[model samples]
Target: MSFILTLANLLSIAAAASGWLKLSDGPWSAREGLMAVEDASGIVMVGGRANLGLAAQHDVWRTPNGSSWERLPDAPFAGRAYHAMLSHGACIFVMGGQTVALLGDPFFNDVWRSCDGGETWDSLGHAPWQPRAGLAVATHNGRMVVAGGCFGSSIGAGRKFLNDVWATRDGASWELLTANASWSARSGPRLVDFNGRLLLLAGEVGFTADTQLGDIWESGDGATWTLLTATPAFSARSGHGVVNAGGSLLLIAGWHDAKCLHDQWLSEDGVVWRMVSNATWACTADACGRFDFWPVATSSGLLLTLGGSNAYSTFGKLWAETWALPLLGGGRPLRGGSVAMH
Candidate 1:
């Protein structure tokens, strides 16, 4: 009887603690390619393509508790998608994304910062780096490191991929650490600060090429990068969500092998990875899938995923819905499918 009671208690705790709770659909319509970053205020999502390629958005949305949301004023910068946004100290910086909806040209190198949780913005002007979209940026060792992206349209007209590395202490001034990185020129890879180093992983060359890179690389300074692994256990992918959660690195859903993936991977030293859960917060069937989503780690040990698209076709649908999961130590998911509030 004692064993039964203990088992019952464990089951009850798992029921409440595990699974994903889908929150509000957010202030905007369905959209993809939005930039989201977590700061002291909460989760702030900015700029995305509305309804696939219909129009680009400059609107800003924030949620303090992951359920209730409020729309802030439109960002002072022009509407864009595939931009890089991250928090450094108390300032939130936004930079380097293409304008127009999804298929247009004219990338942006302008930098903007918000001191008040994205309520208002001030222009920091364009940086010395080339204007490009789908770039990766992360704060490392009290400095911001920027690297790799694509220039030109999504459909291959004048498209060019890049592998340069840049860094900035102040948003106004930027320095090119290396004009060419050790990694191949690619776009949309996740650049994350992991284990006191900057880790870059898994992005495609371009939409036209459809070559997804699976290798992993790391760097202490912005200038020199070392390839950690040429092939990881997880398939090569891009548009995946990556976050350093609870002292472990989590790699979430992405596109691979001409289809959207729904697996989750965790790594401690940024080399070997293990899939903790493959059946949580994503579509199990091929009829529905998601990518280009943003996953942010909260202070309370909850992993929140916001805003991604379900399909890549012209009739594809974008999501403004938010999903939350309580993670165990080392960023492991408790149960594969405990509860889904979608």
Candidate 2:
């Protein structure tokens, strides 16, 4: 970006925050389609969008700490954004994500696995479904469970969403968990593994611009699913960041009511919900598809919002800020942000 753009960014933060920006750094840049996976070793931010006209970049970067980023090997597949990825055991499993245009644009349904800590990646196999994005992925009992997400570019034009549920043991391998269910055939739903069960929350469906709905789905064996939370705390919205912590589930920062969300909600049993963003995190963040959209939970018990662009505009923004979200005491950090996005 031009030097003037950089100056404008500084001013925007000054305008957004009262005076100073309480910013954190990472391997910074403006890209999307990337996702991060964190562990004890460090945080790994993988492939994301590079430009509006350019294809997504598969390059991966690592930060031993959340501050500095080191360039790693690029992903074998074409660069993509809005893709779903999770870290399991020794490998980071990256599933469906949209192409250069963002969610549901260049929908990618392919499967790839990274064992060498995001340095290198190998194609696992093709997903049973066609290339699609905005899908949710979670690992349970050594199996990866995927749900929701749309199939086509526009919602109702030619695209279809998945109420279908599926899981896999190895990336090359696959299994049919559910043919159809009650869940919405929508993109950008939140999926997280809590305790021994998988919990799904929020998302839109059909050609309609449906907003928040209060419901949560629970899956134990991946094959059979149950409606766990009949009552929800917040209205359904897409592209929100959801994570499991201290045996409790926390949902934060997403597009809700067609606008970005600043509220925080917590679920103890993955059903009973309550608000928690009382003391920290004042500004609303962009939904999860863009750079700095996703949040990583640290072992130190702090929730870190990863970088993207300057809050004011998209031009010449820094993908380096990591805003800290204060959480109540007693919960250990669950996951660190590793993947990158433009």
Q: Which candidate tops TM-score?
A: 1
Model 1 scores a TM of 0.90
CA lDDT of each prediction against the hidden true structure:
0.80, 0.63
Model 2, residue 312: C-alpha shift (Å): 13
Model 2 lDDT at residue 35: 78
Candidate 2: where is the Cα deviation over 4 Å?
1-26, 50-55, 101-105, 206-209, 278-280, 284-292, 308-320, 326-342
Q: Tens digits of per-residue lDDT for model 1 on 1-342? A: 245544224333543654566656776777778888778898888988886657778999888867778899999888888899988989899998876643444689999999899999999988998899889999998889899998865564567889999998889888889998999999999999988999999898866325889899999897899999999999898889898987788888788866777777878888888776665474565445578878887776677788787675635867888877766653655453522322
Q: Looking at model 2, which ten-residue stretch has the lowest summed lDDT?
A: 333-342
Q: Count backbone clashes in candidate 1.
A: 0
Tens digits of per-residue lDDT, candidate 2, 228-273, equal 7656867666556777766667776554444545556676787776
